[model samples]
Target chain A: MQHSDYVELTSTRLNPHVDPALTVWGWEVPVYLFMGGLVAGLLFLYSVVVLLRREERYPTVAKTVPLLATPLLGIGLFFLFLDLEFKAHVFRFYTSFQFYSPMSWGSWILLVVFGVGGVQFLYTLAELEPFRKTAIGKWSVWGLFKKISGNTRRKLAWWTLILGIALGIYTGLLLASLTARPMWNSALVGPMFLISGLSAGTALTMLLARARAERDILVRFDLLLVFMELAVILMWVGAMAHGSEAGLEAAHQILGGAYTAVFWSLVVVAGLIVPAVLEVQSLRGKWPHTVVAPALILVGGLVLRLVMVQAGQSFGYGA
Target chain B: MTRTAHKYGMVVDTIACVGCSACTLACRSENEVPEGLSRRWVNQETRGSFPDLKMKIWSESCQHCENAPCVKNCPTGASFIDDFTGTVQVERDLCTGCKACMASCPYDARYIHPTGYVDKCTLCHHRITGGLETACETVCPTSAIVVGDLNDPGSEISQLLRKRKFEQRRTAAGTRPKFFLLV
Candidate 1:
């Protein structure tokens, strides 16, 4: 075939492998990063409970949230390995240090978070077991409770929570530093991710609070956080829309492409509006609607992550 | 001994690129790039319709910038260049495939190779050091692609670049890339 006049015929044969990548970032990477970001945010907010609230009221959660969060972050890293073509090659990150690479920094940060968080969690659980005994142990088992929550476990929990929050926010900063992707280039991304983590963490905390605290408290706090989360998301989307042309194009692709339905339905209606109304009702002592709001908000927050990860891919040049 | 320095690059005439991807294929054979991998590519733009249809092509590869971002951001020093010769090379053994270099590059030229190492065009450093031209330039049917040291005033690349107007991608990114497009 005759080559076009305006285009270059710069090689002997036509290249056969010129198609666009099919599964932009694949399922594992997007899901894993989202999970990691959420875990980071959640762990940070949980620390606030430890540092701010009275020891008697917040100790149960402050002691327990790290136990849950540390594991999720660990699992998130496992999913990250799935994105690699050669999974074992990831180990090289530790053997050789590269200060300029974000991945190298991110991996190290994750490792520290997990290591410190995991030990602290186990320590706090052991400390709690002593209190679980006596009349409390009469309901449970005295020996088992004693073994899980022993003495000397006090300071570890606070340290773990503090480190976890710092690590989580750093993860958000890593993604924001990449200027190549206009969609991710905004200064808003790091803070947005931090807020997202708070939303997810609090949603999970509220779910747990339903069992531990009064239904009234759970319903009120959960609904309020849901409203705040939704507002953050809207601000994020609006800022993206008004940014650079490339950024706007990226946002439109999110609105119209694969992420559209999830953004509008799950994040907006399910995560925010519905929850806000139900929470308002809960504040007014309307009990029945409160249950529905938190559950929907949980599901909606998850959908928000799926949409954000998948949305980044749609910005690729099809040609 | 005086150091022998070379800064390799390409001069593509955007007006002559047909989007046939011939340069891409030549690079694969010359460099033995894996089946699903490529060292060069052409971006196609289609506009208008029917009899008034028009398409433009922008051929791309590693721009080999004077201020290469990949070299700057590589964490393990896996992605580096010869300070004397200016030939950027990747040390596969050291690469962690963290995809950090991929993000730092303004042109999106770098990628995680199948071997979990970073991969991209290296300007055929081996062949050119043997006093041969780049595969893309040697095989170009229309002679649309050129490669040489921009520092060499007598080189064809330097002459053509000096004689005609040229453009580089993402000028605002301030890469000062060696590659130029005669648009």
Candidate 2:
């Protein structure tokens, strides 16, 4: 058999940030994603608790978690701003709305979240004894909230729920919409991030809830979310495996490539599986309820974003 | 038949290229592209075994696609298609430097300029709009690079593409790139 060996030598003025792979988005992006996902989970869970009329049973979730949404989202936005090369031009995002751009959609969605979430936060604060005595809390806005009917508040809760879901999915869709990067091109990324966000939110709620019943219910919900997240992760990888050449290579990136160990150990096992197992045991009364499970879940959720953002940038069609 | 807008494009005669990188240098000198960054670059590909060999060299840059993903994905209206020339150009003032356009570009043609804006090949819009050839085209020793309005049937680029066999890079990306490489 005759053998034919092929070699190609090419050289160009290399742009380090773009050439072999796009490394433009750094730690700031992942941090922003993690924070955004956390807030999304908090908003979704708070809205659900309100809609179910379970606020009495889950007072901490109803009152405390809603207060954290705006602050956490603010932190996320700050990190996102830091990642911008032209920091002064950040306002340009709001100047014109490009319908096809996910970042545009995200900026707008976040604005709505802040507005509705702000109202929700103020209402929660007005009810609290510490806030009622505060100088700013004595303002007329609390009186305005007082006149808002229960039905109208429920409608507000519905908006919060929808916005929460949108914010969660938007975090993933931001990357998924970019077809240039094969790893993030899958539609499953949206649902995956949403589920993970929900799990993180539930875990945080469990950690803060002083009532035993609240923690018990949240533990079960977090377990279910963990399972859903695992399924979505499988579907995300499976879809990539069965996709085009670039996509298959993208799947390999986390399956056994550079991201494999961190992805499996930090994100899957430590983040999802272990927390799930502990929560199940706690439900069975075989394990003592501790902060370990929820803490693991929060860490896992952060690691998931870090891995996805970094790994997605490590490969592309050009790379 | 009515005359339409000028659809600017480029055709590179790979056969005639000598891998001298004169085009890349000329482009840098003319554009004042910042240090360690370029709007265009040269590629040299060699294939086959020691017994038989084939080499192809060509200058490459942004395709200025009719369906540019950068334009579609830019959160701000910074990256846009020029109406008159039908070329992809950036509005520096509107760019947020979010790097979304860079991530969306399959050609890896865009880079963050030192002035903190995403920049890429404009197809020498500044020169071509004034009825002049691009810096690279003017300096090509072998006359390997041809830039013209593809909408004009008699233009050199259109005529060359019609007469010779050519290939566009990453056509599957659905960018509908105008940069053609003659095989």
Candidate 3:
């Protein structure tokens, strides 16, 4: 295989050099992150309603959540499945537990969330004493499960809360674990995703709350979460700016570079700040009951995920 | 009798390169790598003023890092450094095509196959298992690329690595890369 003479190059076009992985992961990943956050956030709220015994005051959220949370989680898992290049090998995610990989943490957390969330949904159904004695309930194990009583439900609610928090943080840690992408390298990313998840969850529940008191309370909490979300985003950027060049490079793209316009206008202004102003006006009775703010919050949460993934990929750490 | 542990590594003599693309051809043919993607690539980086122009050739691929961020970051055990030779290898059947390893690697060495698995330079593990040198190292026209077990004091790579000044790729990334560019 040795050649003594210098070999001459022919065509350079055959092996064209390209930038490394600025577009490796695309839209599907962000969508999955958003949905996962939403599920975690929603279930956390559901746990609050059940464990805190606030179900009487927020019956709309309490009743609907058991039904809503699991399916939303399923949809999020579906998006995760869609992103996998090996669709048939989806079962591999469950085959082992890898502590080093954040993706491993996510798979296990997501499964636990689904399991606890599904059980909670069933328990909520069985708790209905009137429905349990009915023909529909006795058709299956619902009648026997109805005898499970309040103690099991409480245990499940506690499990749900723990797993919910894990799942929420895992969404951000998933990307933050990628040290190669300096944009995502931060200890604060988990809290950032958690706060966003809370805000998005509040907004999602507000959309379904039919009671006057429930909507009003959610609006107040949603506004608080939105404020916290904005603050965390600023803190994240500031911390990155103070530390390393790679972080700054990533921060530059998101804060002032190619993504500046869309991120600020679509994500910050229309999605967050404007909606916050609208929510404040409604709280002061300047405007009537409206879905605009809550809707905007959800959109902003999704934009956060999308922008992070896109700009983070565009950023780099190696030559 | 047991096979002795070997930390196989490579040193590329950048000064001797002729931009031949011969190593790339050898890698492709040996590994049966798909088109439009490669386990290795050649790039040119030019520096200095117009009057003192100089160009450097970078035949880039997986660094086969000692710490191996890709191995740690891979959810499955598919991307692992071989226990016998201590060179990285991928289990194609075990890979789920999640691209976690690909994203985690700083070198950008891995790519997804059409059948939905990640592939990257293994330093020709198939041939090395039978006591053969890597195809790229064997076919180099200028004898620019050298490979051997760094742990063995008698090996060619160790001797070259000790006498020559070399720079590692992305050493600051904390990956502790094994691939070296002999200056």
Candidate 4:
């Protein structure tokens, strides 16, 4: 049985230290986590292509994507550490094995994804041999080239894609699991990441596609992803606006507060809108703008993540 | 050693609060809290017509909920509720400072302290272990704060609840906080 009662009490002296005003913790954490989630999504998309499909056309871009992601994750993690009072003791989370913690789960997932993605990239380069039938070395052939160039490699590529997507999406689910932060507590956060990651991944793929003159297929795919990402962003923002007070504050901080310009103008406008328009133009048989659109979309996707992470950090869930 | 399910909690009488700021000093002294930080605090509210305005004070801190959202959202398992004492304990060493708990808490009960570890009220677990009341309860000038077992029908908290009604902070959040607010 449940009962609701309002109890009354008598006079007691008060304390001054507990200010009724909100604290700083609300603004910093969510934003930081959002950035990390986006970084993971972007890298996963880039790596899956290189690792699973053997799309080894642009090796430099493939490797650079992960390198770029490494710093974002590291920096996001540092902000989190410093926000918590710069205590080294908190580092024990990395060492302790707790199945229930969302942080532990997220950290572990990131580590595995990054580790596997990195190795997969290096292995791709190793497979691309320049000696078997080189124009200058036609006289001597080595068997090392044959081992990495077959269907076996393609199957492994598929496995890597599957793994990367799973890890990439898990990052969002981990955040959403916390029901208290209603902004992040929705089931959509997982799909949000899933869709966003694909869009970001597509953005990255389009960039590479343009670089290697494989623009036709990659550009269309990137355009579709940008469209999908826009939908996800709308839903994500709507969810935040409709949730509890904490969630509202978190959303407000992003949509109308500190994160507004970056989210609306940069992430939504430059990132999604410009690219969407360019994509439409291309679909209408305008080929010149197709190249520029994917590049803009890529930048936009990165900024979108930055805004989400920063906004999450700016709000605290409190009464 | 005999183990007991303590279910320790606190009851605050808002009517008896005088807004004197003494419990703050006592808790700070007992915990050696950093100069800028406090483990317990009071929230003040002003109500009624301007000439007839009334003052209300609330002592706010961790409620040590039976179903703490902070503990669940802590990705590092750094925050936990001690089953033996019902104290929400933050393991500084294990905290990643991800601030996931801070975001997830409906009452904003947890904070990343200056020490980089999540910090909040611990229900004076150390004091209670030494056969003493929480520092806040010990120093309340008007006996406005009562700490005891809510499960025990004879305990002061339970008795107060049975005879007079009380409120818990953010009850809708489903935290089931052990701290009771008496109006």
Among residues 3 or more apart in sequence or in different chains, the pairs in candidate 3 whose N, CA or C atoms overlap within 3 Å are none
Better of 2 and 4 by DockQ: 2
Residue-wise C-alpha lDDT for candidate 4, range B1-183, written one tens digit per residue: 112377788888888987676787788788877776667777776655545666668676778888787887776667887767766788777776666676566666655566566677887888887778998888899988888876678988888878877777767567777888888
- Ten contiguous residues with the weakest lDDT in model 2 chain B: B1-10
Stretch of 10 with least lDDT, candidate 2 chain A: A1-10
True contacts kept of each: 0.23, 0.76, 0.31, 0.38
lDDT of 1 by residue, B1-183 (tens): 112376666799878776666778888899888886667877765555455667657668888877665766665677787655576778887776656566556666666566667788888888777888888888777778888876688989988898888887775454667779887
Over A1-319, each residue of candidate 2 has an lDDT whose tens digit, in order, gives 1356466657685986986667999999989988888899999988898899888888988889988988889988999999999999998988999988988999999999998888887777777888889899899878877556343668888998999999999899888888788889888998999898888888888889888888898998898899999999988898999999888888898889999999999999999899889999999999999999999999999999999988997787742
Question: Model 2 over residues B35-136: C-alpha lDDT tens digits?
Answer: 799888888887787769888888999998988889989999999999889999999999989999888887889999988999988888999999999999
Give the distance in Å from residue A219's predicted Cα in candidate 1 to where it truly belongs.
6.0
Best by lDDT: 2
lDDT (CA) for every model shown? Answer: 0.64, 0.88, 0.80, 0.64
Q: Can you write out model 4's per-residue Cα lDDT over A217-301, one digit (the tens) per residue?
A: 5556666767777788788788878876766777886666777887888878887888888777766676564447766765675
User: What is candidate 2's CAPRI-style docking category based on DockQ?
Assistant: medium
TM-score order, best first, reads 2, 3, 1, 4
Candidate 4 wrong stretches, greater than 4 Å: A1-91, A128-159, A211-213, A239-262, A290-292, A313-319, B1-4, B48-54
Q: Which candidate is the best by DockQ?
A: 2
Q: Residues A86-156, candidate 1: write the lDDT tens digits.
A: 56667776776656555667677777777767665555554565644646434544445345434323454
Q: C-alpha displacement of A290 in model 2, angstroms?
A: 1.8
The pairs that clash in candidate 2 are: none
Tell how far residue A113 is off in model 4, in angstroms. 1.6
* DockQ of all models, two decimals each: 0.29, 0.68, 0.39, 0.36
